[model samples]
Target: MGLIDRFQALFRPKDRENEPATVAMPPPRPSSVLARFNVEQGRRATVEEARRMYDEDPRVRGIIQTLARDAVKNGFELVVEGPRAEEAQDVAQAMLERVDFWSRIDDWVRLTLRDGDSFLEVAANRQGDIVEISRKPTLEMYVRTDEFGRFVDPMRAYYWADRLASVSERPPDHAIYFAEWQIVQASWDRDEGSRYGQPLFASARKAYKRMTEGELDIAIRRKTRAGMKYVHSLEDASEADIEAYKQRNQAALNDPFAAVADFFSNKRTTIQAIQGDARLSEIEDVLHHIRTFWMASPVPMSLLGYGQDLNRDVLDEQEKQYRRTLEQVAQWVTGQFVRPLLIRQWLLRGIWPDGLTWSVEWASKEVSTVAVLAEVAKAVVALRATGIVSDETLLRMLSHVMPDFDVKAELARLREGRPDEIWRMAQLAGGQDGAA
Candidate 1:
């Protein structure tokens, strides 16, 4: 029977106990094609080849690293606010520092950016203290499904060479999965439900291949030696003489000095230099491919270390958009991976508090240069001068411009006749003008 017929038979309803008796049927034998399909489809595409190419290809690596670096450039903070808020925050911070969390997160981002999906197997001691967190290659891991074809929590993972490892073992709860992008509603029959991530550069594979081919073509063109066809009258020459001529010609071609010496001796020989085009067009084509790859990337060219001829306004806009993207990534990583890990740690440490709520805060995305801050301060002062904003509103706006601004303290000092430094500066300037 076909695979579909077998599936139907397996899932077909059985006669109820109260219903009429029916003969028990034997399970259908598995089809060879079905077995082969399961075996082949279950295996993920080998990432080593793509990873090797990514490493060797500077352009590819640059794009991937650019995206990854920007995503986690600002790092993140664990904000725990609840009954045990302070303790939770302290514990989380301590654990983060102990594990060098930022460095591990950076590695996770880079791997996911390059390989589509990155895995972190969380290892803990008997006391449930996280001992080590190591990255696992996507090629070595596989998903496991239950009898109902639903994915089993704690999926089966194994090394490619470990044929004896039982496929039925459930992965530990600490195994964290981070993917750059995933397809939704994909077919399970084709293993699309396996949660394997599609690499960002998978779409640009063809362009990369073309680029390599172009490079090879250019190299081959450069290394090729010009050749001249020799025509001689063999009518008067014996076989030995012809053989000797062939050997001499081969030797001369191998050595430029020998070829010049032979030129002086062989008066009957005519030399014609064969020339080829410089193939400068291939270089242009390769550059075009590189540009295409960059354009296809999610990151902007400026972020990938290409800032030539870029407008300041355009770059600022690109940075703003890129920062927003990074913020979203930070949110996703926190929700999907970091939060669970922290919660698990809390549970292990017996610090799991009731009604606990935690959040991850990324660094400010706005440009924080001195010039930018000055501009923001000017805007806030102008708004406050208009008298249209309330004192509370003015303080809130000023707080955004300067996080260290203390509205209540400043107000108390002003009420006590102590002006701010800026006010003192204005007074000094006015007194100097009067004295002059």
Candidate 2:
């Protein structure tokens, strides 16, 4: 042997018994509503169990096995079987017969997955289009995905069927009969006209009658997802509409919880379009664009629409003559009155002014806070003679100006120094001219 090989061999331990085998444990399940289904990690022995169940209960197991195969292929589990299977299927068929099977199925599927993590969880209803797989969830709340088979929508046919199976396992044939009753009732009342409808109806009627005579399948089509349709199946069915549907659905499925991100992204695209005024016809065009892109969204539509309406209202007000007068008044308040008030407040704080006022012609004069107060007092008295604002309105306006400046406290302090100033303000309000 080479020297290198010998060196490695010297360190090698003598062989003994092989290490004990360890069965790999399944991954930890997150504590979430999705865990309720108890989907087994890997294939496990479910197929075998299903097969054995099939052999033992051929009548029920037959359909269960077929559903199981579809489940495995579609990445879901079929939990319904026996009489329950017949009932849910009957109901499904009825729903399909009445509405656009595809559309109805999609709605039902969306409702189911609204609560759980289905592969089809991100699909949303956007405007009028069914966005199979959007970065954002659909308005209908269906999970969007790029691939049909990859993501499981809570409204998967397998899911609803599986739920039915579990109930059937517990309650016997009565559950199935009830499910049939529900389906038939909805189908009939809704004017469902499936070719198989009459046959299924007759079968349900016969079975229900037999139960009165004591031979009934007690199976229940337990609720899963929402609505009565299979939403995931629609996502899968979209595969035929065009290959892009499934692909898009799968992509959304890959990131099911990113509805906000998707919604914002769509919003961003719209905002960008309107940002450039050169591209749009006018401000109205931009506003309309926002309404279409932002307001039409499924979520917060009312909230967003309200804000947009308010903005539009303001714009509309600006166009009307009467409202325009109010608008100009507001502008004057902000620019002339409010701005000057703020500036005076700041200057008075620094200079410790007792009071201040200004000339309408913009000329300025001031000495101390007392002098300013005296000048404003005299001007107001003269103005009162001309009948501008009533004394009540002028007092109210003055009260607003020095709201926080404690007049009594300031007068007390001024009295300690210049008691004459206190008499001056008293004269302005009521003491001096008697016109007060």
TM-score of 1: 0.59
lDDT of 2 at 92: 32
**lDDT values, one for every candidate:** 0.56, 0.29
lDDT of 2 at 139: 18
Q: Compared with the true structure, what per-residue lDDT tens digits does model 2 show for residues 128-201?
A: 11123211121111211112112222112111212222311222233211111011111111112211101111
Taking all chains together, each candidate's TM-score versus the true structure is 0.59, 0.14
Residue range 1-436, candidate 1, lDDT tens digits: 7432332222222424434454553332346325433543433443555586678978678777776676666565455677778777777777777667777776677677666666565554555455566666555554444333433332222222222123334344544332211101111112343445656676667777787898887777665633343345445566786677667667665574444535232335445555555444547788788777666576777876777788999999988787777677667667555775676566555565445887665655454676666566555555645778754455445444453455557655656765455443433433322211
- Please report the candidate that would top lDDT against the real structure: 1
Q: After superposition, how far is residue 156 of candidate 2 from its true place, in Å?
A: 47
Best by TM-score: 1
